[model samples]
Target: MALLALVLLAQVPPAQADPPISQPAGPHAVGLRVIQPAAPREAGLPAQVLIWYPADTSVSDAPPLRYGDLMATRLSALRTDLSATQLREGRAQQQASLMRRLGVSGQAVLDAPLQARSQAVPAPGRFPLVVYAAGVGGPADENADLFEYLASHGYVVVSSVGMGADGREVEETLAHVEPQVATLQALIRQAPQWTAADPQRVAVMGWSWGGMSNLFAAARDPQIGAIISLDGTREPALTRQIDVQRLTAPWLYVSRSPDTIAQIQRSGIDTTFSLLNAAQYAEVTQLIVYPMQHADFVSRRMREASDAGYGEYSRAEVRQAFGMVALYVRHFLDAHLRQQASSLEFLARKPVANGAVPHSLRIDIRPPAKP
Candidate 1:
């Protein structure tokens, strides 16, 4: 609910252009392409995905991806009449064009070109795969910065263009989680057509409701190499659906607040029926970012809030929160997806005071309790 509010409240009358934000500090340049994959099931959902990967060619000639379209599609999915409105009225395309004209398309990178299908790096030289699910009513590209960042760093990042929620109710949200995850898995299977992607070394991440879906997906398929949750929590109904006892993949949960953890515990989702529930789940590392909101995980929110002068933080402060989270994400993926053990040190270290921005990062690695 708070996650939804973050998206809703952050939207204000267009003001000055978004502040200049730092790009991901990866060595290789980023490339992006779009795909429309048919759902594996009769979910009536055609997954519109954005693929970001390492690029060998110059991407400066291309135009930035549309921000309004991604934001509009995401917002539409949250309402009950999405099909009748955006789908029937043809608003998605129109909205994207409008945003582009507004000069607030929210492009992740300036002029990152689409990589050619034929020139893709060959097999035996594939990159680790990552499928990221957006929060409820949030577009896959909501965290475009992170996706581009990971791709530039040599990981194939696949994110959906629009993950329809259809309704705002909690139960409606829960029912859609598994289907979205399944859709993501179906898209990953199309890796051979897009780039040199290694599906075997896959990682799945989500925010809020998507995080709940991430847990369900990992539970269903233990082969997932790792899981990342950006302030995601499991409801009582979700725990009833999947047995978390079967989850074994490594997990990284970064929370904006403790109330979420408290909610999970109160809902009886933290280790009552299953021996390996949240409290007993091994291989899970939890990180808390203080003075941050649920929306901070979303990069676009910071820029929008800063431009509108809506939130408490300044442009610099907002960029700082966004940067810290991005750094941790890069480190976590580097450690798990790339198998770089040393990267974990950045996550484990305590934050040092730098005056301008407060570094209130808390890390806790939880191993399975003694049986």
Candidate 2:
């Protein structure tokens, strides 16, 4: 399966330190903390939290978050199994293939400098807060373009990087997701930036393992008004298969229709059937498909990202796939935060030919827009 290849290929990104690329609108100061509950729980481990809010571009005193044993040392161990050159080559090859498929050379966005990553224009006001959690072993920068776009546009979105993958082993990646969610909720309680946050305007998003992380977080976090999952599978986080229906918030599931055809064909109908049998429904649940590969979601880092049997994209699909996800996310967040009546209109948008697909969406009710 491409997912298997993609999972294995995930190990090859170079371990080299990201170059010092600073965002210019501000120096981008940083703060770091660990959220380990005072009490014990199963497989208890400390989760790290990093805050990178708006900073003065002229400032140079910000300290980088330390992955500690996760990134620096553990990745060193993985090198024993996978050579650095091989990983770099794999990443470079994967990236090159994706770009060729996406069209255009160097013009593609990757490894952007801080000045370039920064926004010179100030936000209209303190934007809504978006809390993000990457799936097991997912990188914070994987969905970077989207996160940066939202932040630049005025929303404060926070993401937690999982501990597994890379050359290092983390809290066993998937195993750590639940705690990540717990810690995220805790952080919201512990921090002042959070109380100042808009309660009605918050959203959560994740991809792959991050998607599961996103769902688990939302299931536990009532403050999250909405959620988005990018090509994430549901099997990983379920304690019992019947637990899928626990979700109550608006949800948007974005999957690559053809890329996951085999995966869905193999298990789609069965899962959807069970999803319904389990009584899982949403006030707003919609799935959007793009004519691109699963890996296309990470357009910014296609080299370091790949999957087996994953074909490359043409420039058009790349523009459509990545750009589409961005647009979908922005629209979803705005609909929830600003409560635009038209935005919630999607909850009501569905094909007339509902019989054409095995699964159909049901939006219970759309809330009236804010005054």
Candidate 3:
């Protein structure tokens, strides 16, 4: 039966995958570049930082960014135990799956010239800076789509490789948190030097473990004007330790569907305590996306996963939800960092009012506690 299943899987023809994520609604063209910061060798920071910012050049003829290459390299490192024949077969299968899932092309053009550098000389104004923190031990570009979208919409997005204190697999402890926080602070400090980033309007966005790290960064650095978390900061063990008084930035927490009582009990998660609840000092907006699991928060994972990966939700539905996530992040940044009345009003409305599918999301907004 196993052999027959394998044969059937191989014979299945690839269907047309979903289209690339929609072009952002921003007026500016997008550009991507990598910067290598000069830090003392013993400081233990990432060697390269990826920056996506509004560009002046046309991307019409530029080659689409190839995310598959990065995925393939990561996969190869993890599959060293496979025999040569098995490895080849696995690669072939992966290629086929990718064709059927989403094509490997990402939205950004590689090393595209900065908006200021291009010949099309636009107005001279600094854009808000957003420092992205990837999941623990994840690559810097794990949320490439979100970064690209934000860049197009007039923000300078910066990120570095997510690593632990020992520079290996990140464990869930304060030790692991220290390095990630340091990296985010370093990126914030370097954003202005590398690009036209507004130091006063900085935001930190994180996924999973990086999400928790951003909270720590905000607690220590008041300059982080806003916070965005993707299905992050649910760990009771970790959230209990955050100094919520210092975490006064307006926060947007996008979470997955709530766990059932039985599931919560089974996992030993304390349902009574929550970081969001504890954060009475900041204006908080909680968006619960029903179609997404924890892994689905990362656009790259959503694009790469198989049909089973989405579970009950169709690929189209999940894709739409992912797009909605991007939109919410943009609006949140705009509302807080840019102080745009339109975006602030957009966020003030319910998801349905903002054009989200009915019943797809549950949103709760909490105004900051009166001091």
Best of the candidates, TM-score = 3
Better of 1 and 3 by TM-score: 3
State every prediction's TM-score relative to the real structure: 0.71, 0.58, 0.81
Tens digits of per-residue lDDT, candidate 1, 1-371, equal 99998787666423323422354456666666665545423544344566777766444444444444344444433342455654645554544544564355333322222222312332235788888877766766677667766776778887764354442333444556656667666655666567778877888888877776777777777567888888885555565676556677778888874556778678655454432245365477887776567777776565344345435555555566556666777778888777787776765666553222445667777776554
Q: Which runs in model 1 stand beyond 4 Å of their true positions?
A: 1-24, 38-45, 57-124, 161-173, 259-279, 306-312, 353-359, 369-371
Alpha-carbon error at 100 in model 3, in Å?
A: 12
Best by lDDT: 3
Q: Report clashes for each candidate as comma-separated counts.
A: 0, 19, 0
Task: Please give the lDDT score at residue 223 for candidate 3.
Answer: 97
Candidate 3 segments whose C-alpha is farther than 4 A from its true place: 1-20, 40-44, 57-64, 69-124
For residues 109-149, could you state the per-residue lDDT of candidate 2 as single tens digits? Answer: 23323222222323233556777666455654555546555
lDDT of 3 by residue, 64-133 (tens): 4445433443443322346778766765676666555544322221112222222222225789999999
The TM-score that candidate 2 achieves is: 0.58
Order of models, best TM-score first: 3, 1, 2
